[model samples]
Target: MDPIKKIAYNCRQATYLIEKQQISSITLKEKIELKIHLMGCSICKLFQQQSMLINKMASKHFADQHKHISLDTQFKEDLQQKINDRLHKN
Candidate 1:
């Protein structure tokens, strides 16, 4: 494939990997290609930054919300039992 097309493909794959938190899953050559593409593509770079920021903010928000919430063990066990009973009945 041509260099431009290859870079574009790499950028797309990089974004997918980033969103899935699987950057480490990509091969070394893919990482190198993605880095090179990011260097030349301002739009992709901005996208990467924005995606990371969104993920960070979401994680922090969820963490804070979870801290203030508690679940009763009995309630959980009862709910699971009820679900199992309904499934078996059907």
Candidate 2:
């Protein structure tokens, strides 16, 4: 099998586990394999780490938002505009 395909498969699975929080937290063979791949691939490592960080931060942010004002639509719009601008630049 191609290395790119292998990495893509692992990335999809790793993201699911990261976002959904695997059913078995104690069993992390797949997670370990992902880390092993990350150790060698800087790009994959950055993507994995960034995704995990985003997931964690979003979870906590939503959990905390229950205390006060919620839904920052302007922030999201600004973010989208910035992203679009950057994408168009390329």
Candidate 3:
């Protein structure tokens, strides 16, 4: 197989292993791999970090929604927009 295909396969396998919980999220291997990947591949590293964080937060149950944006900062703006019909005003 081509080197590109092999690299992609390896990345896919790594992601699968992580997603399938085959690797200890807190293990030394996980930490090292994450750091190394982050150094080499920013996009995949970011994705891995976010995916792992979500999985950990969900406790492997795969909840319907992963997170809620607290209405603390944007709430006021959203509330004002709603009241003023800002989104459709234009």
Candidate 4:
């Protein structure tokens, strides 16, 4: 199979790379592969665009929200204990 075709046909890899690229830089090979795949795949392109928009909106909202939010130590400890209890039960 052609290497480009292999990359282009794997929507799963294309989508994973789309998300990975947002968090950090993908390698040169990965960037090229993802570019090739996105050019041919409309669905993956839409997903990439939507992912960018969502990340942008979340960053904007969270930046403001973080300034106003705080949790006391006791509440944090109780929440952690409940999470631990749930994990142990599972």
**Maximum-TM-score candidate:** 4
Writing each residue's lDDT as its tens digit, candidate 1 over 1-90 gives: 998677765767767755655334776776777777777778778888898788789889987877967789999999999999999999
Tens digits of per-residue lDDT for model 3, 1-90: 975445444666556555655354456765555445445666676777899787687775555464653567588888987988966877
- Candidate 3 stretches greater than 4 Å from native: 2-5, 8-10, 20-39, 60-90
The positional error of residue 11 in candidate 2, measured at the CA in angstroms, is: 3.1
TM-score order of candidates, top first: 4, 1, 2, 3
lDDT of 4 by residue, 19-72 (tens): 999999999999999999988999999999999999999989888877967899
Largest lDDT belongs to which candidate?
A: 4
Instruction: Choose 1 or 4, whichever is better by lDDT.
Output: 4
lDDT of each: 0.76, 0.67, 0.62, 0.93
Better of 1 and 3 by lDDT: 1
Measured against the true structure, the TM-scores of the candidates, in listed sequence, are 0.55, 0.40, 0.34, 0.64
The deviation in Å at residue 57 for candidate 2 is: 1.9
Q: For all candidates, what are the clash counts?
A: 0, 0, 0, 0
